[model samples]
Target: AQSVTQLDSHVSVSEGTPVLLRCNYSSSYSPSLFWYVQHPNKGLQLLLKYTSAATLVKGINGFEAEFKKSETSFHLTKPSAHMSDAAEYFCVVSRNTDKLIFGTGTRLQVFP
Candidate 1:
């Protein structure tokens, strides 16, 4: 079985500062990791994904995540934050199947 834990339930950042959302994963085998973002009244969007190809994966809106097998981490990061970036983020794990295990989610609050 595979599972993911989001270290932080909430994250805050200034409009121009960096953003980091921590996530740790556990899987029996090589798993596909993903970061999804959801804005107010909107559906979840694919931010980025890691499928055993590259360690560093880039996503939409300046977001990226690095897959670190040694650390068992796939933390999401952005160089700068935006007001529109305020939303809920999810860390997910999949075993090349249709089933997706989601984290509790982290709410990102961007301030001016």
Candidate 2:
């Protein structure tokens, strides 16, 4: 079985400051990890994904995440945050055709 834990339930950042959302995952086999964001009244958007290929995966909106097998971590990071970046973030994991496992989610609050 695979599962993900979002270390922080909420993260607050000032506009233009860096943003970091921590996530830890457990999987029986190689996992495919993903980060998705959802703004108020909006559908979920794919932020980034990590397959078996590259450890460091980049995605839309200047967001990226690195897969660290050694640490069992796949943390999301952005150099700077925008007011529009405020949303709920989810960490998902899947393994070999299995159903996606989602984290509890982290709410990001960006203040201007």
Predicted candidate 1 versus true structure: per-residue lDDT over 42-61, tens digit per residue: 99999999999989999999
**Which residue pairs collide in model 1, if any?**
none
For residue 54, give model 1's deviation from the true position in Å: 0.6
Clashes of 2: 0
List the global CA lDDT of all models.
Answer: 0.97, 0.95
Residue pair clashes in candidate 2: none
Against the true structure, what is every candidate's RMSD? 0.6, 0.8
**Per-prediction TM-score:** 0.98, 0.97
Q: Write the per-residue lDDT of candidate 2 for residues 36-85, one digit (tens) a residue.
A: 99898899888998989999999999999999999999999999999989
Which runs of model 1 end up more than 4 angstroms from their true locations?
Answer: none
